[model samples]
Target: MKLSKEMRGFQDRIGHQFARPELLVRALTHASISSPTRSDNQRLEFLGDRVLGLVMATALLEDDKSASEGQLAPRFNAMVRKEACADVAREIDLGEVLKLGRSEMMSGGRRKLALLGDAMEAVIAAVYKDAGFEAAQAMILRLWASRINAVEDDARDAKTSLQELVQAKRQKPPAYELVSRTGPDHQPVFTIVVRLDDGAEAQATAGSKRQAEQAAATALLSKLEQKQ
Candidate 1:
C-alpha cells in the first residue's frame, strides 16, 4: 500500500496520507479515463457528498446554537454545495493530480468546476474509507473553515433575493442579457447584464454564465440599495 512519490506529494498538499494507496489512485481516476481494471470516483463522490452534508449540518448547529432551522438551512447548503467543494479542491490543486482521458484533458477538464468538485468529494470519501468518519470530518472542517466562518454574512443567492425585491415593487422579473463574451473556448469569460424595465441595470463578467448573472444581480441590488 505504498504511495508513489507523486501521489505522496499530493497527500502532503491535502494533509491526509492514505493507508490504501489504491483508494487514492481510484479517487483520482475519472470516468473519462476508465479501464477494465480501473475504477472511477463516482461511487466515492456519492459517499463523500453525504459525509460532507453530515459534517456541515453538525458544524452549523454547533456554531449557532440559537439559530432556527430556517436560518441554518441556507448556510448548510452553501457550505455543502459543489461550488464550495470545488473551491477547496482548487486550494489544494486537486485538478493537477487527476487522471483524465486525453479528450477531457484536451478540453480543459482539469479546470472544469464540476470535475474538480466531484474529485474533491471522491478524495473525501477515500479518506473516510481509509481511516474513519472522524478523520474525514477533521479534514473537511480544516479545509472548509474559512467558508464556514463566513456563512452568516449572506445566505440567500443575490439573484433570487433581487427578483423578490423587484416583484415586490410591481416590476417585471429582471431581464438578463448576454452583453459580451471574451476569452478562450475552453475558458471563456461571459458578460451578463441584469436590467429592469425602468432602465436600472448593472453588468458583470465572470468565468461562467451563472456567476456573471449573480454578480450582475448583486451589483444592481447594491445600486438600488444606495438610492433608498
Candidate 2:
C-alpha cells in the first residue's frame, strides 16, 4: 500500500490524493499479476469507463453551447476512445506507477496499450470515487483541453475530413475492408483496412466495425499529414 516518492509526487502534481490508497493501488494493478493479496484493475476499469463517459458527456454539454446530441456524439466518442486515454496516461507516466507481476513486467504489460488505457480509466474512477466528480472532471479537463478545443473546429471529424481530402484530389472515396476479427461474437475485435485511391492503406482495430473504420480513417489521415 506504500507508494514510492515519485508516485506520491505524481499525485501531488495532479492536485488529488486517494483517501483510500488501496483504490489507487487497485487501479494500477494489472490482472497478469497473480497474488492472493493483489487485486486486478478490471472492476475499477469498468467503473472508470462509465465515470469517464459521464464526465466527458457533461463537459461536452457544458462547453458546446449550440451542439445537438448528433453533433456531440462523435466528438464524445473520439475524446474517450482508448487510444486517446492511453495517450494521456502516457503523458503523465501512469505506466511507471503501475504495479505489475513479474510476468506482466517482463512481458511489457506496462506499455501495453489496452492495459495502460484501462488503468487510465480505472484511475479516473478512483479519483471520482475518492474525491468527487468535480475532481475527476478537473483531471479530464487538464488532459483533454487541447483536444476539446480542436474539436470545436470543423476539422475534428477525422473520417469525414479524410474523405474530403481524398475527394479534393479527385480520388475515389476510400474503402474500408474487414481485415480480421477476434474474440467472442458478442464482443468482437474488428480489424479494418482503409484503402485510398493513391495506393496507400492504413489499418486499425476496434471493438466494432464502425470504430475500426474510424480508426483506420484516422490513421490514413495521419499518414497523409506526415507525407505533406
Candidate 3:
C-alpha cells in the first residue's frame, strides 16, 4: 500500500521511511477505530515499550558507566515515561496523523496525552519491525538525544527530592495547598502552592493538581538550592 502524502510528510519529520507502509498504517490506528479486519496499535505499543526500555537502558549505562543501578533507573524512567513519550510525540506532531473513530475524534483524542504516548510507542515498534533493532535504536537515539543528555536533571522527582531536602534539614514535610481551580471541568487548570513549615513557599499552575504540585515543589526546591 502506498503511503498518503501526509504520512510521507510525517516520515520526513521522524527521519524514517517505512519500507512496509502497512506497518505505519497499523501504528497510526487506534483501538477506537479498529474493526474485525483492521488491527489497532495496542500490540505495537507493547512491543515498542520494550524496545524503548532496552534502548534507554543501554544509553543510560553508556552515558554513565560508573553510575549505580539506583541512579540509572530514574534516568531510564525519565526517558521512557508516558509523559516523556507524549512530549516527543507532540514535538513531531504525531497527533496529526492518528487514526481515530468518530467518537474519539469528537472527544479530541488527538490531543489526549495517553493516546499520543501510545501512538508514539506504536510508531517505534513499527520502525523496529520494518527494519531491525539497529534502525530502531538509531531513530530513538536521534529523537531522544537531547532528553538523554538532560536526564540527570529530569530524573530528579521534584516532590520526592524536596521532601528529602527538608527532612535532611530537620524541617516538617512540605504541604501542598490548592489555591484555585479554573477552566471547564473537562479541562480544569489547577493552581497549587507548596509551603514548608519554616514559611518557604512556591506557587504553580498546571492542567492537573499533581502536575501543579510537582511544579510548586520544583520551584521551592530551586529557591532552597539558591539559598544553599
Off by over 4 Å in 2: 152-228
Backbone clash total, candidate 1: 0
Poorest stretch of ten by lDDT in candidate 3: 65-74
TM-score order of candidates, top first: 3, 1, 2
Write down the lDDT that model 2 would get. 0.82
CA error at residue 72 for candidate 3, angstroms = 0.7
TM-score of each: 0.71, 0.67, 0.72
Better model by TM-score: candidate 2 vs candidate 3: 3
- lDDT comparison, 1 vs 2, better candidate: 1
lDDT of 1 by residue, 130-154 (tens): 9999999999999999998988554
Better of 2 and 3 by lDDT: 3
Please tell me which predicted candidate would have the highest lDDT against the true structure: 3
Q: Each candidate's root-mean-square deviation in Å?
A: 13.1, 14.0, 13.2
Mark the regions of model 1 whose C-alpha exceeds 4 Å error after superposition: 157-228
Report the Cα lDDT for residue 172, model 1: 94
Clashing pairs in 3: none
Lowest summed lDDT window (length 10), candidate 2? 150-159
lDDT of 2 by residue, 1-228 (tens): 687797787687666887778788888888887467888889889988898899888888887654545457779888888988888888888999888889888999879898889999999988988998888889888887887887645225667878899889999999989999999989899999999988999998878786677778877877889999
Which residue segments of model 3 deviate by more than 4 Å?
157-228
Give lDDT per model, in order. Answer: 0.88, 0.82, 0.91
